[model samples]
Target chain A: MSNQKLFHVAVVGATGAVGEQIIRLLETRDFPIEKLTLLSSERSAGTKLTFKGNDITVKAATPDSFKGVDIALFSAGGGVSLELIPHAISHGAVCIDNTSAYRMDPDTPLVVPEVNIDRINEHKGVIANPNCSTIQMVAALKPLYDRYGISRIIVSTYQAVSGAGSRAIDEMLRQSKEILAGNTVEPQILPVGALPVKHQIAFNAIPQIDKFTENGFTYEEMKMINETKKILGDDSLEVTATCVRIPVVYGHSESVYVEMKQDFDLEEVKQLLADAPGIVLQDNPAEQQYPLAADAAGKLETFVGRVRRDLSNPRGLNMWIVSDNLLKGAAWNAVQIAEYIAIEQK
Target chain B: MSNQKLFHVAVVGATGAVGEQIIRLLETRDFPIEKLTLLSSERSAGTKLTFKGNDITVKAATPDSFKGVDIALFSAGGGVSLELIPHAISHGAVCIDNTSAYRMDPDTPLVVPEVNIDRINEHKGVIANPNCSTIQMVAALKPLYDRYGISRIIVSTYQAVSGAGSRAIDEMLRQSKEILAGNTVEPQILPVGALPVKHQIAFNAIPQIDKFTENGFTYEEMKMINETKKILGDDSLEVTATCVRIPVVYGHSESVYVEMKQDFDLEEVKQLLADAPGIVLQDNPAEQQYPLAADAAGKLETFVGRVRRDLSNPRGLNMWIVSDNLLKGAAWNAVQIAEYIAIEQK
Candidate 1:
């Protein structure tokens, strides 16, 4: 560890939910860091965060914040990433963005390290992390995709409040308490859209995650559809998604139905998933063992279970995938990319 | 109303979650009942319930409980139905069962009043109500099936805890309070199965609903599959389901993917649903209006929204369906069948 090459790292949106996880991952993984810089919006600029038993005060992020920084991780929002990514690139720093800004940009690579790490080398400056729901799904299915080719996917998500941000989490908790206390709740932060309407997230399921697109799908659903194809490098693959938000605090659970190109054995399919990288198989029907969001919270690995052959279509398979939305879906994925870059540079 | 002939009615499991809803519907809808008899297990036998402002004492359900019953409604567990339904039949009572025991029985007619009311006459003695999750999906899709022949269906459910029973609802509420207080919870009554494994349903999603069948699907999933085919009266229709238990208290939401035998116009599809019986169309993406479980709670109508054509298959459509599992899914559906019987007899 002492002989490794040390690089300077900068974390934008350091006070945000995903950004906090990124800092924690970096500290726990013992990443070779010569120096660390924390950057947030001016509203949160003066906040001090502790890392490795030392205090580092956050500064307001600007185009000039990337100077001398070897790698810059961004999760503030799409607006911040779109405005500052070019400056970060011109300063000779590779950017790992955790927003929708550069994800579908043709030049930028959308990479889930387990699914498409090779594409990380093709990035001009930014490697975009797929949506939190998409990351766990593709990571769990990549092994199956390799074993037997996949032609189509239909997915329905039970997503958590944390994917929307920390405020959404607080809203769910507060609303839940309010409902439990027999009071009417005023929803303020869910189904985050341009409209004034908000739905209660406590004891409810909100079908809309982001604003509706022209095609009648929410931005979150379209992200899962478009980003899955991009990360898998298969534009011809068919994908449809319905993303719904539940009251869970951290993990996102997905019900995935995939139509394979060839007929496969169910036991072999289970074994392939069990052997996959970054995927833990928890499917034991006799024992009633399956993935639950509460169990997957704070974990880095994606959990897959409830594997069964579709009774209607011979080539179709059904399974459940779960993961900590902020961990594998955002922070750990970005950190894995940074680790790959560190190894390549060394 | 004074000229109508009234019949003696009995309600098994009168104190249950679904049974309570049934009694409320009976009172609100002004059903022509000459006498209302409330029956329960030996444990809750003496519970007092008021119907039409008359106090009725609950009696322990037994083989002789239906001796003079002209119409009997059963919402107790399947064990009670399987054991006592035949006795009700021998005593000449036409039973409307909300349990799965007689749903697939060839002699019994599984009736959803809006979908297959005509089949009610074929019942030997019992008319079976479909599973709660299955009831809502089929209700929403029946209009579409009539307009465009449905070839296949794939559904993923976000079900409420009350579907299990009143005890499960209490467990969820208690668990949520414990979690809010930052204490660990010991789950005792969720994922109700033969095995002893229980999952935390507060702020979590459980993939298993009932016990797993030999085919790797839960009994709840199989109930949705087999019951849909039987109710639709089409043995060739293909169906698949993934039933999940969420933290909600009342309504169940479904994400359904259906492929039709004929091509469909999206606007025409919306019009058909809006005009259908017992279905309310809440689908206006421009106004961010879609079906939500929280909003659907206590409502008897099945709410449909988020209708869109599949990106890959021209004949395929995706929709979101929500309904109060106790009302439209169970109690209201059973009552609709009883109403039809009363009208037929009159």
Candidate 2:
């Protein structure tokens, strides 16, 4: 450990939810960091956060903030990533972005470490982390994709409010208390905070996650659809998603139906998932054990359960996948990539 | 209205959630009833409920309770319905059972009035109401099924706790309050109340809605799969469902993917749904309008939205369906069947 090469790392959006988790993971995982820089928006600047028993003050991120930084992790937002990534790259720092800004860019390899870590070398300067909903799904299904080729995926997400950010989580808790007190709720944030219409997320399900795209699907749904194909390196893969926001604070649970090209044994499929990297299989019908969002919260591993063959399609499979949207979905995924880059440099 | 013939009506499980809704519907719809008899389990018997301006006491249901019942609506548990329905029928009462007791019985007809009202006449003695999750979905898709001939369906449900009975609803409310207060919750009623293993329903998603069946599917999932085929009268049609329980109170939301036998024009599909008997189309993406479970609560009509064409399969269509589980999913569906039987007898 003493002889390992150390590097300077900068965490953009350091005070945000995912950013805070990233900082904690870096400290707990004992990453080879010689120095750390924290960056956020001007509103969140000057916030002091503890890292490895040392206090680091967050500064407003700008084009010049990446100077002498060997690696930069960006999770502020798509707009901030789009603006600052080029500057970070120009300073000879590799940027691992946790935003949608560069994920669809052909040169920026959309990498889920467990699924396609080799693709990390193909990145010119930026390695894109897939959407939170897509990360847990691809990680859980990578083994199945290797054994029996996947043709199509139809997913319906029960996403947490934290995926929309911290304010949405606060709104859900507040609205819940208000409803319990028999008071009428005036929802100010939910479904899409940017959108004018706000639906109650307390004791209800909102089918929209991000703003609606031109095709009737939300941006969140398209991210899962497009990013899954890219991360798996399957241009011909058929992926469709219905992303919904439930009142949960942390974990995102997905109901996925995948049609495989080859017939596979159900027991062997379960075995493969149980043995997969970064996946925990909790499927046991007799004991009533299955992956649940409340249990998956704060966990780094993607949990897979409810594995069964579709009665309609002989080669089709159905499974429930759950993971903390902030951890495995966003922060942990980016850190996993960062760890790979750290080892590669050594 | 005065010329219509009146009949003696009996409500089994009158103290239950769906049974209470049935009583309200019978009063509000002004069904031609000369008398209303409310029946419940011995535990809930003698509870006084109001109907029109009068107070009626619920009685413990026995075989003799249905002696003069012209039409009986049953919303009790499956075991109670199985034991009492035959007695009701022997007393010359036409029974509409909301339990799963007779839904798949060869001699009984499973009716979703808008989809298959004609089959109600073929009932030997009891007409079975489809499961709550299945009811809203088929009601929304019936028009599309008729126009384009659906060949297959894949559905994932976001169901409310009330479908489990009033106790499950109370558990969710209690758990939510506990969670908001930052106290640990001891869940005793969700996922399945009878199952030994309990899961927290407060701000979480439970993939298992009922006890696991032999096929690795919950009974609720099986109900959706089998009941759809029975109601649509299509043995060749393929349907698969993954039923989940979220922390909602009254409405159930379904994300459905259906493949039509014929190629469909998207606009025509929307129009067909808008013109359907008991469905409301709430799909205007530009204005951020869509059906939400919060808005669908207490409504008799099923709300359909997020309608789009599948990018992979040209004939495939995707939709979101929501409805009050106690109304269109149960009580009202039974009442619709009862109305038909009453007119037939007259």
Candidate 3:
């Protein structure tokens, strides 16, 4: 091997759904990792998971876990990140968080590599990844925004179950089987929020993704609205979102209607999207081709299809965007930030 | 019993999903029915069903099926309606069609009973029921349109599999089980358009509902756009729709964003919607109470919830509308028309 610097990487929440994806991606991608530290909560501390064909035991993520860590990727809950991120920073480790703990914070730059990779340089010690639904939309819409100057966005999402965690995936699958067998089921962990009420997610759609805020918007919707403006570095853009969770296991699909400040030709807009980075255009209606969540389950790139000019408005455009919520939405975005940091260090 | 003038009613496609609902509604409602004639295609001609504890055999629908029929409810395919509606009209039967064959006809009134019952008198032998997705939206928005005057509507639907037909319901159920069991499934009946491509509706969402027109909007989407303007009687109203089929078995849900011509008070708007006939208000965020598809199934009223004013636009509002696709969306709408006809005849 060439003599290149291999940095020590610490992965917190290594056993969770997105954390698992981060570990798998790190093992598969060409990253310079000298030591791989898999850290989790106390419940899953002793679990053994293999990475790069070597068995690694998950350790409890204490403040000292990042003693020699060069870059730490955090996918744990917000409370864990809040308590431990400062400690990791004190130990001279850069934190790339996938949770909503510090996304809207002015100090922590929210990064979507496809949309705003340059924002990584502005991070003091932590760079937050945007929400799963927001990541795909911004990534797909960045090209359009750069070309025609977006004014407003109205998006309705068809989110998957995996965004809730692995437990939610289990809950959806179990509830589906029970419903299919004519057996009743009690929902335990859906519409994950501060409330006690839980709605059924089997063969149904839940409109509220997170808890409702004071202004009658869900926390998840607010995250999309706020983080989109932050990531695009435009505070004046008008954005509205209706975040919905469907029974799909992995990908999140959005029906986005955007209004542009300047006029746009439909053919030129399609060409712009086709030439954009990290976007795959799939909009042939005659062949029944469009971006589907099932087809985008394991893929890293965002899929954009059903692109058409809005019938009523001259400058409005409609599109359907799909991507694996875990990979591109969370893990891969964090890893891409970490890779950028690694390359800068070299 | 009150002596009401009983009319002979014929239900074409009686064995189909919507046709079955119409028969049941006729049995339970106070409609004056002297004779009930069940008609279907040749394949299902001999099937027997019960109405008011009396057995009726399904007859093959033809020109003579409406010989003595005072009002005929047609839910058969569009081809059947296009071919046989003229014969029914020639036989002096006032046809209330549930198919799209006569929906866009200038002479045929596209009716959502709550929104356009007064237009029933203008029908020239055939009154067309609006699309299932359109029926719920217009019924929910009629009050707002009457109060503040709607200028534009942008809607995204989470439609049910039942909108496709009974066979689609079976396919969704079967594929859901196969998917839960980790077996591969071949989709056959979903995205029920002219195209040969089929998508798995078990845990996925299909963006295309009906066949796409030349402009890339699906027929279902176009139906929502065109039918909204027609049913509202405002050709100047701007409307757009993205119809998507999810895994729900019944009850279509829509995330609707509308721009009103006049300003609206949120509390007064809620009061107006709550006081509106044939509309249910279910918007309480604190208790996690909202209109759910599972709860809306088999209900007659359209449920409106999550009503809020848009943060950016002064005249914009966002709401969630849901209803049983088979009830208010189809059979009940037709039956409501037929009941008006009976009242007028009396």
The residue-level lDDT of candidate 3 at A249 comes to 97
State TM-scores per candidate. Answer: 0.99, 0.99, 0.99
**Candidate 3 docking category?**
high
- Report the alpha-carbon TM-score of model 3 versus the true structure: 0.99
What are the per-model numbers of colliding residue pairs?
0, 0, 0
Off by over 4 Å in 3: none
Number of the top lDDT candidate: 1
Off by over 4 Å in 2: none
Restricted to chain B, the TM-score per model reads: 0.98, 0.99, 0.99
Provide chain B's TM-score, model 3.
0.99
User: Would you list the rank order by lDDT, best first?
Assistant: 1, 2, 3
lDDT of 1 by residue, A1-346 (tens): 6678999999999999999999999999999999999999999999999999999999999999999999999999999999998999999999999999999999998988888899888989898988999999999999889989999999999999999999999999999999999999999988893578999999999999999998889999999999999988899999999999999999999999999999999999999999999999999999999999999999999999999999988899999999999999999999999999899887
True-vs-predicted CA distance for residue B93, candidate 3, Å = 0.9
- Fnat of every candidate, listed in order: 0.79, 0.83, 0.70
lDDT of 3 by residue, A1-346 (tens): 3787899999999999999999999988968999999999999999999998999999999998999999999999999999999999999999999999999899999998888888788888899989999999999999999999999999999999999999899999999999899998898999883569998999888888989987788989899899999999999999988999999999999999999999999999889889888899998998899999999999999999999999889999999999999999999888988888988887
The Cα local distance difference test for each model comes to 0.94, 0.93, 0.92
